[model samples]
Target chain A: MTATQALVVPRGTGKTHHRPSRTWPMTVLGIIFLAIMVFPIYWMINSSLQANSGAATTAWFPVDLTFSGYEAAIQQQGGNLVTSLIIAIGTVVLTLVIATPAAYGLARFKMKGMTAFVFVLLITQMIPTIVIANALYALFNDWGLLNSYLGLILADSAAQIPFAIILMRAFMASLPQTLVEAALVDGANNFRAFVSIVVPISKNAIITAALFTFLGAWGDFLFALTLTSTPQVRPITLGIYNYLGANVQQWGPVMATAVIASVPAGLLLILAQKYIAAGALGGAIK
Target chain B: MTSLHVEAAEARSRPRPGGGRSRSRNRTLHYLTRWLFVAPAIIFVLVFFGYPIVQNVVMSLQDYTTATFYTGIAPWVGFENYAKVFGNPLFWTTVINTLLFTVGSIVFQFGIGMALALFFKRHFPLSGFLRSLLLLPWLLPLIASAAVWKWILDQGSGALNQFLGLFGVQPVPWLVSPSLALIAVIGVNIWLGIPFNTTILYSGLQAVPGELYEAAALDGAVGWKAFWHITWPSIRSVVSVVIVLGVVYTLKVVDIILGLTGGGPANSTQTLATWAYQNSFVQFLFGQGAAISNVLIAVSLVFSLAYLYMTRKEVDE
Candidate 1:
């Protein structure tokens, strides 16, 4: 048994190494590629901590680090940050509410043109948001929703639902049919069965959808910037633009605000890393 | 699994409706409930998302601007805006630039993504963490990601130049040179896009059965040969989907350019999206801007229709 166990371990190792020990070449290439990708984030973090002049100095690392940039950005954008948070959170809540039930219906019932509904959603996703940005601004202004949190929420919420529906539906359809049938035979009404049986089984997928909606809401820039004029309702992303329009570039604070704004989405990505990876790959390719 | 949990809970709470009898009132209630479940989403989209699209079409025809303020139709331009759009040299330049950027970014992005996906398939230790970390560029909001890139690519004292100096190469003006600026922006876009493609392709690759590769190896296929013979066939559907979606997405990209170059250093980097934005927002040339957007929409629609057709063909086949 000892000999057999020892044999199994090397066999596993041998099979993997069959590809070759070209580690030097592969690692060098990978490091170059990853450096190109990672440098920007590194730059952002580095510059965020440096003073204004220090940022323009030829140092990749912060020679003199400070949190004044953060302090200033937060002081300036404290209200805006709260507004962005509200809009993002609101978009997620609204999307989940609308999409979850529709997804359930699409999954369980043999609705007419269900495939068509999915197609419609794919089409909508294809349309560039900028194409409709001006028109939306005009319409929102007409309806007295321009520069309002509710307007941005409504726009983003609309964009998010189709995806949420499809994601939930796919997860639902993959579920065993007999479970729903069993619930029916157990005398639960359709609504009650869907609520209890379908919803619970699709929890992971729903959570994945919720996470995606949150990312979309948080990352949204064109719509948020275009629709809102006032600092009161503008998201953190739009606030970054104000830095560009200032008398000077203010690279330190800009980087600081950028890092600050990215934290929520970055944290979301790191925390939901598994679900997000699964969702990104599965949601599209599968 | 929320669905499964819901099913189990339903099993305990309600009395079983026997299979044999199809009750009329129950079926009616089911449909009504389903409709109710779906209505709010549909209404929300129709009011906000759907209505704006119709308004866009109407706005494109009017010669409204900041001055006119939509106080009636300025004139019934009637494709005059569109004709002028086509006639504009800058419009054509933007269109060409947009196409090039999209094509360039997609090719490199997909190539690197595919390579990474194939590498990840071997399942080395800690590969999962690497894959997750790889999502950082895609995960960061575009503004932040682009801002970070802007700082790194800044001409005077950015990270890229500073790093290059260590190797004794002269510092290059990444975002200041017209020829290099577009490519620089493209490079950042590729970074943001590759992790996403890798994840998607990796998942697609995983769904391909290991048995085929085993069989191919048994028949003496190795490395590239085995992958070509087995993996490619299995992932054809997914690859097609990715290509179509990638084209549509890359075409619509504006934020990265806006944040990084502002379509600047002589407008060499202007794409249709940014051009549309600059026209309406900066110049306040609403009519021409609307026309520019209409053209973009038309181009994108053609791409989407092709995608839809391919998807249909895949389903049919």
Candidate 2:
């Protein structure tokens, strides 16, 4: 949050709220630091637009912006981008279906060892993806799930299920227990009460959880890299890495892929910023 | 009708399970259905998180290989894989690299993040917009960022070298040279980490009551003294959580190193994470890979346990 919240709506009649000296100098300083931090990203986009003309130097601006690289990128990586989308969407659906109920259960029910169970869930977040990948590789190999969309979806969700549970549970916890409890008196079973009341009431939290799982699955590289061997199943994150390896001479297409690859992070910041913040806080606080 | 509904609710909410054997059985069934909501999540986490941790340990003890992928046999090799990984010179180099990478990242990220948080604490136009924009680094996939950094840090035609050329300084081999590769990687990691640190630290600063600062100002505690006395104490919990989570997350960094240098230029940027990936996938030394990762896991568990301890009160409440 910015000091706008403090200034426009007085939180307290204290020095923090009434620091009326809003300065342009601070804005300039903040912008300078931001530019420093984001220069690489700028260069990535700038390079993506410019043609790689075998020149030793890159143009500071895309003065003569070319679409050749993007054309090549689309020609080559469009399928991989589609693959990433399908996986991300699949993850969102799967996570919501599974994590929503679990979160409601944990937040509402009096499960034995609930505290210990939640603690263990938090610890699961710290388990390196490599450890999970190592075991999953063997297990998937055995179960014939490797190189399949279902496999990656299951793996990514398994890795993400704990965080999803914690996040949605934190949100769902605020719903008065009587909401579902009341529904139970209407001759509805527990499952019906959850579907009819809790799920509909917690729409924002569910979307937040779903968006986060979307982002996670979209940006996932470790699982994409280690689990899938065939190009038929490669996500764009892995496709980008593979492009960097195979097309060593083409920085243009690579940067183009990078830019295209950043769409979710960009769109989410612009569109669903509120939900993202809620999810971030949920992860930290819960 | 209302009385009948209340009766039904009372029947469902009975405190004692002694009405009859049939009633107790129904209670058990009711509770089982209630638990079914959480059962899938618990089972998934167990098979995923719980099983892998134990499997990694077991695999580290055994001799798993690419061949074992088909053969379905990884014979017990005892501690040989662990011994082999430790005895290797690359292991020590990676350990040192891991420490330097983690420490360098945390120190700069925290310092810069704190400074930014303090700056943004005051009111200004576009402050919120700019603050959110800072999260772009986190949103960009680490692999994408790494690819861009590789281009920017490219020695021969890099944007950095070209910028330095304007200063009449010679082009520096940022990623090619062994001595500078780790530093370069650390620098990029710090850049990636700053937004996260700043966002969290800024939130922490927001929670510090305005009244505390006002009270301190009345006592002539301005600037540094006010910060030390008022701000630090209030934000200490968030600060610890930030740094601990930073360490835990930073240790598992693989995509960036892989994208930027593939842990190359004589393996200068190789940490335990990248090393583990290389051994298992690249070199087909699955057992050794699992061994190094287990070490990484052990290091991570220390901080995660600390994290759990710190958050226990918040979680329970």
Candidate 3:
């Protein structure tokens, strides 16, 4: 999105050789905006570091740093963090396996019911997740999938797969048809041509989908709350939730746990910025 | 080589749009391959989305409870569940809460989001970086967001109160007060939603051809006049999309509320979504929960239909 930003930024901004007079005010105001938006995050980190440890009289800064919160947070929430990672990885693999081919087909083929299929995918997004969970709880119970990693992975992927398909399909739709058509001339079948030709071209889209799926599964609370009854398959999100349930005064550890869970998202923001931006806009526009 | 040539020739002949047995068989095979790709997704949708909807409706009509899980019997009660829901006084509170929460969140979120988008539209140094960083709140697992906000809004130790103390302002019992809980939830939700609205609205702002601004400037229509005439008109579709989606997404908000207040201080923060979860999971009254959710679904369906209608031209285009 910053790449797109360079086009619209004023001539006096980054494009210019020297600083412009008016740019400073806008920059100052912009920083103020960032500060307000990011202060809660700062507070979370600050309070986590303070020895006061959830005291009402927390200093503006840590003043005195402490690792006790981090120690407690890891000691308790570490297993759930691993659970989140496993579930997130499983969702990425499963979503890609299912959605990639479907996205390619929807983008490239003129299959019957294509419009209806797309429409269904869009409408499904509108359905409140509670409605799905209500049914899934019963279904998972009967299938003995409750509190299992596979169940949560499949359930979380349900939310990711449709959006992934739509996102990848949009990218795939713009690809030149001749890429795959040329491969067909070699004795490769449709699936083979797709695997060898189409898949390589859609790497960015697949990565975007994978990142989003990982995030969605890792951040998931609804399905994990509904489907998982025991601690065996609990996610980090739920660990923070259980911390809140205790309703303790020592929020230092709770904040630390939340900060731990948010690390990947922060890293992804700085590293995979473009794909993150694309996913943000593309998924919503559709 | 000859065989490849014949296959290419056959492919060229595909435009005939005719029906012969062999040609029809080939058409069936092609369709079959395409459907194969979509089949798994379709099956998942049917089992997950499709079945849930039908099951919810069916469950709503019966006396389904925790006992029914073991007995495999949920006697039909017809519209009794609906009647009871309509008669229940908490039902109305939930309806009002849902509307207030949805409308309040969307208004501020859209309003501030618009301001932020317009602010960042004028490209200054680091504007782009700051704008992207705004998404931090949104990208965090909402549960994590809720945990932080729950502490921040705490009457005593919360950061908000502590900050206010410097100004000699008394602590506000944000989540614990009945009148203030819903408002506080809306505030947190607005914070969560602002980044999304900004990103989309900013994208919409970008799509406005810059030439129009230049052209409008020549007409001496500057500032608000230029925006009202050119910018608003150009991005009206995006505004509609953002507003409608904000409404839809806000209507289904559960995790944040559950995390923050648990619909307490006399169930003040209970929206239809949280109420549905309370009935179904917490209280184990599946039928009543399903009934409440059906109403929520109806509400969502209205906005979703409006959204689809608004975006129809884009879809067709």
Give candidate 2's fnat, 2 decimals: 0.61
Rounded to one decimal, what is candidate 2's iRMSD?
Answer: 6.8
- The TM-scores of all predictions, comma-separated, are 0.87, 0.93, 0.94
lDDT at A52, model 3: 68
Q: Write the per-residue lDDT of candidate 2 for residues A111-199, one digit (tens) a residue.
A: 44555677788888887788788888888999999999999999988877777888887778778888887889888999999988988
| TM-score leader | 3
**For residue B249, what is the lDDT in candidate 1?**
88
Clashes (backbone N, CA, C under 3 Å), per candidate, total 28, 0, 0
Give a tens-digit lDDT track for model 3, residues A10-72. Answer: 222233322568888888999998899888888888878876666657778888989889999
How displaced is residue B196 in candidate 2, in Å? 1.0
Using DockQ as the yardstick, the better of models 2 and 3 is 3
Candidate 2 chain A weakest lDDT stretch, 10 residues: A3-12
Better of 1 and 2 by DockQ: 2
Error of 2 at B65 (Å): 0.9
